[model samples]
Target: MTVSRRAGLLSAFLLPSVLTATTATGAALAQEGKPREVVSTISSGYFDDYLMLAVDGKAKTLSGYYNDGKCRFIFRDALSPTELYQRSELGEAYVVDSWDPDHPDRHFTTTLYSKTPNGYRNQLTLEPGSRDENRPKACRNRISLDRSSWVSESFYDVAVVRKRGARVFTIARAGEKPTPAPRKDRLPPPGTGVWIDRTYSAAFSPKGFVRLNWYDPPGTPHGGYVRQEDLYPSQPLPQRDGGDEAVQ
Candidate 1:
């Protein structure tokens, strides 16, 4: 999409109704209060925003979601109503509910916890068949026959695996971006975008995973929505002063 066209789309998305949550009451309601484990009900709000992963050698994918609010969660092979939740401070965060928004039959459970100066721990117990060694993986293609559509354009990187005979074809993004045309283009070539390293494994199966993550910025591209400066004058996207890669 052209720069001007991309801007218009973003502007429409950033409409007042689509604004991010910030109310103290609502946030606190969604906050992790102590630790609890039991059959629970979740809101579609949890899995709303996410990152995608594809396993080139397998028949699954790893899907992740984050709350613009203290939590980010990822789910492997949508196995059951049981889900796993992870939390981090200082960035967009929120809890992820496992129930499907469109289909009420599917669900998952997760234990909530807090990591302070003391140590890391889980506050809840396993639900029925939940595995002891908690990790990440994509769901069986059963739930989302169209995993491609379930994810956003920026999340195309999640589909690393293609069915040997059951091919899950994706709308390969636009061709290689020779360059960031005019800074207002609507999309990035499938290969270009913010990338992170991750290993996704399927549930109840032998542990199998590979590291590499790919992602693109949301919306058409950088141009009609005004700069982040104009919208949130109170806070700005952080500027990293310095950083270094650590040995794994």
Candidate 2:
């Protein structure tokens, strides 16, 4: 697959109008005052870009990766009680509210964090069609905590030509030329899900590039590269009985 082709397929599937309903559903889910099981949170670079992995008791796990230390976190319970989730190390605290009344999802709308001047602020909002527009769609983008790594499961859309469809695509890269990876001769249909385990990099890259290991359902895994923009980085909860070191 080439960059041009991937963009074309993404654009074709992203018919705005067609995906509007799906996006709305995710926003709606973020609001419900449901109780969520604590997963894990990983923060980097002044806490601007961070990943929170949580579950709803059921198998459903939601991993949210927000850049600039700001993004809506649809949690079942408030992590703090004093109106702000404060971080003494960063000298900043976060506030929460339901800005979108119509699309309210028990989650805070826009960004609700500020650095204390205690009055200095880093005003940021997650408005519709904003910079965060490229975010992954809920349900379509699933996050999981596998052992110690925060894994993201999503499908790749292969475009169909006159008669045949594409199986491989040239993945996009950050601040560099795209790289082509080996692929299977036969590819699943456009909607077939090709799950990937997101590889993390502590090294900061504005492009949000990540290593994606392709999984054949219950089989082995393959390797690939992708940008972490739409996807969020997640930290796994503290180890259970096994007591393994979590990946950073």
Candidate 3:
């Protein structure tokens, strides 16, 4: 699809009210410690292309490419911890959630993952709105994978602090001054490990900054932006003496 068409489809998927409602639902699910469901949609198109879906069961993630011969888009979703128990199913199954970039607040959970003879597959029932206007009101399809694969590693870059007292900010724009990260979202002590999503790192590269997320001693995740200069490419290991030693 053309870029303009893709943008229009995404815009139509989520109205302001729908976005607010779904975003609230996602937040509630997180607060309740409930497993998150995963879903995906193509907006509008014939289901003839080679739609590939790969699952990393261990990580509870699903990722794949959607190709319609003309255009291709990549999607990945984190699956819920809860499993679906069905009488005829073998192995495990979990709920999946998917969202569009234009309407991040809106999420769908109409897809399901199941173990198959070859490996794993996802069976998805397309949402009414996601289908072409002239197509059937109900649509379903399956995408299978022969093996599980790690997808997160490809999307993030790992780094560690280069010096003590380095700071992270909540936002870092190309031309605007950055806003300091809140106390709760501050970077951990120097030499601690942190990671920045490739998407954010690349987007803010013009500003010489990268957003980083790290875990405090308690294992809680905190994130903020930091200047690229404050980080080193390698993560150092903590030595017995409380200092960090470069990895060989």
Give the winner by lDDT.
3
Span of 10 residues, lowest total lDDT, candidate 1: 224-233
Error of 3 at 24 (Å): 45
TM-score of each model, in listed order? 0.20, 0.22, 0.28
RMSD of 1: 26.2
Per-residue lDDT of candidate 2, residues 67-104 (tens digit)? 22222232222222122223333332222222111132
| Candidate 3: stretches off by over 4 Å | 1-65, 69-81, 101-106, 121-141, 144-248
**RMSD after Cα superposition, model 3:** 24.8
What ordering of candidates by lDDT runs from best to worst?
A: 3, 2, 1
lDDT of 3 by residue, 93-142 (tens): 43333332223344443344445443232233222123323222222334
Give, for candidate 3, the lowest lDDT window spanning 10 residues: 40-49
lDDT (10s digit) by residue, model 1, range 94-169: 1222322222234443332222322111111112113412222333211211122222222222221111211111
Supply the TM-score for candidate 2. 0.22
C-alpha lDDT of residue 180 in model 1: 15
Q: Local distance difference test, per candidate?
A: 0.26, 0.31, 0.43
Ranking by TM-score: 3, 2, 1
